[model samples]
Target: MPVIAVLALDGVPGHELTGPGMCFGTAARHHPHVAYELRYCTAPGFRGTGSPAPFRIDTPWGLEGLADADTVLLPGHAGFRDEPEPEVADALRAAADRGSRIGAFGTGTFTLAATGLLDRCRAATGRQYAAELARRHPRVEVDPEGAVVDADPFHSAAGVLGGLDLCLHLITLDHGVPVAIETERQVFMQLHAPAGAEDATGPAIRHGTGPHSLGPTIRWMEAHLDHPLTLNDIADHAGLTVRGLNRRFRAETGLSPLQYLLRARVQAAQRLLERGDEPVERIATRTGLGTPANLRHHFQHHTGTGPRIYRTAFRSMVAALTWADGKHAEPAEPDGPAGADTDPGPSGSADDRRAARRRT
Candidate 1:
């Protein structure tokens, strides 16, 4: 199992300290195969204080714990504006030298910057402190607007949600998109306390300008992913000519309109695969891929696996996870059972079910 060492400092944000665990723990719980050992460490003789809630903490590990960690995470603390302890800086430097991925959350960027590891690397801190970070560390390029900055081997995030994004991203790097997507859904469920509801992120483009400029258009695309939406249709919805739409869409999101739509469709298919034993043909139609072959081609291209294998793998993983947790794996439900096949297939007719059954 990979080891992730989180450095707990005085006044560390409670949310940041636990955010990575929520993501990694959920991945482990759901998939079991993508397990990680999360370790919490602190500086020598450290008696840390939790943020917002005045409480004391005692960490189990010291700076030595970072020596062999696969990744090191630094959560923002009360004294982030001040220089990090000399021993802490040295430990971080040694970890970097040994090729450990180091990340800072929120104002923790200041601590990382002080160590000189982020010099000449792009980093992100809280927007309110962006100017101060740039002024203090002239060599570091500070992105005030970005939620997270990925400077290989070294990363930084803006705030709590940014920290969550970074944690999911690291999981994605370690495992794959499938595991990451499921973990994201699990985190969303915990945040919203809702059952079987879609997360707000919704498999859309993550890196983009604010929704103020393209909210309606993006929401429309998300709502109509099951439709055979063309460029003209999207442009019409946006009330822009093709050329203008292309320009503006590219600006709002890094992808072109069709590219974004296709990604959304593929992601939607992934969720279906992870959540249930839906047939590939039905999933393809529901996700607007139109045909199983098309779904397979694009799904493989984007996720590096076929839909059938993806579903089978998820089921097997969940079963293995259940067994590992000292629980018996639930028996599989009978195929096409009443209420199980209630979801209408592509054609909204009984023939659609027959066709899906045949294809499956």
Candidate 2:
């Protein structure tokens, strides 16, 4: 099991701490073997205050808790524009030197940046603060629109919601997409809905009326992901020319038609890989990537791993989750080539796809 230490700074956003806690806690409940031991630690002489509200937080551990952590998370706070305490900065540097992965959410990136560990690395913070982050730390490449930036052991997210994205990304890395998706649904979905109600509508379904509406066309594209599609095909279905489609797509979704198609295909493939037992080649065929080679190429390009590795990790996580529920099953070992693909982070649909496209 991995150990995660969340730094509890004064004025930390309540959601930043609770959001990751919810995600990691949910994963532990469903998959004990891959669970993480989460700790909340404060710097020496710590005086804690809540964010987006006024409250108090009392943590049990001090700076020493970061010594043996597998990962250290820094959450946003009202004082993000200010430098962290010297002791906090030193402790973070030591943790990074020891090779513990570090993650920052919202304004937390500022604290991490203050440590000088993020120099020459890509990172992100809320769009409103992105310019300021860049102005303050020119060595760090700041992305204004990215939801998440994974610079290996150092990761950062753009907003409060991006905190959940960062946590889900970490879960996906520790376990796999299956566990991450389950945890995500648990965190984001309504709990009181009827059993079958959730599965009845796919993510693409939207209820609205407008001239800039691409809802019907998006739903069509999602439903037909298994078919080989072209920009012209999408334009034709949407009753517009290719150029007109491109304008509408960029205006409404901030993605080109082809980019949108590719994302939809990748998302569909991920679902198939996570929930089914099909071979990579079959999944590729089903998702209209044409061949396993094509799937591997695109999957690695989009997710940073190959299809077989994704299947193994996802299936193993599913098995672990099921096992925790007392179901008897053996997980398939990850036997493919060493390099397997995983999602870049929390991304889906038009808005998420746009953010991902910008990161690439």
Candidate 3:
């Protein structure tokens, strides 16, 4: 089994620590063949207590624990904005030199950025912090819209639940899709399943004072997914000019208003596909994608899979996992429907599609 070193710095968020442990631990229990030996390591001279509460973390591992790790995960800490300790940077650099995969969870990307490993590489942090990350580290290409970014040896995940996505991605790479999908279903209850996993929930709505908060506008957009909404309509509803809305949306959500609306439509389609047996043309009209061909094009472009295949594959997996006999079984292979290509298209990885959207 590969040894995974999870480094928890002072003021580490309690959830990030337990989240990965739960994910990897559940995978081990459910599929022993894909097991990983997980160890919690701390920075040198670090206090055992963490911020946001008064709880102590006692771990037997230290910086030295990363020496032989097959992978090292850095979760967010309260002081992530501050430059990492020189010793921590040196140890991380040394670990990278040893060919261990280094991943930054949420704001921990700051610490990885400090080590210069992520410089010139693409990284995804929380959308709220994407602008700041780009500003702070001009050399690192910050992907604001990506749920998770896999730049080979350097990986990063966006937002609070993004760590779960990163863990699933790692599992997908190590084992395969079936194990990762089962691990997600058994572990996280499918709450934050990797990007392609369909759900009713869309991207989080930002809440704040002044122009930054797009809660009302986002809700309006969601409510009007079936209607053809233009940029001016959205900007008018938000009481902002087109340029201002675009700028603010980019700053707050890391996506332009239209891009956000496009994602909302696609996500709405996902929910419909997952819940019903509607025809592709009817679903397209309902989601305002206009036509079936357009829906197929955009859905494939954004999600890396067509609607028919996604629905088939997702339902098959759900059925496989929900066996009545209380026995685990491999997911059923999705029989590709006519006109629905099983190929994910030329967009490459999900990360690449997200990057393409970011560029747009």
Off by over 4 Å in 1: 194-284, 287-360
lDDT of 3 by residue, 173-223 (tens): 788765665565445335436667643233343334454477778778988
Colliding pairs, model 2: 305-340, 305-341, 306-340, 306-341
Give stretches of model 3 more than 4 Å off: 49-54, 190-360
User: Please, what is the TM-score per model?
Assistant: 0.56, 0.56, 0.55
Q: Tell me which residue pairs clash in candidate 1.
A: none
Error of 2 at 294 (Å): 35
- Mark the regions of model 2 whose C-alpha exceeds 4 Å error after superposition: 190-360
* Worst window of 10 by summed lDDT in candidate 3: 324-333
lDDT of each: 0.71, 0.70, 0.72
Model 2 — which ten-residue stretch has the worst lDDT? 324-333
Candidate 2 residue-wise lDDT, 64-84, digit = tens:
999999999998776777788
**Winner by lDDT between candidate 3 and candidate 1:** 3
TM-score-based ranking: 1, 2, 3
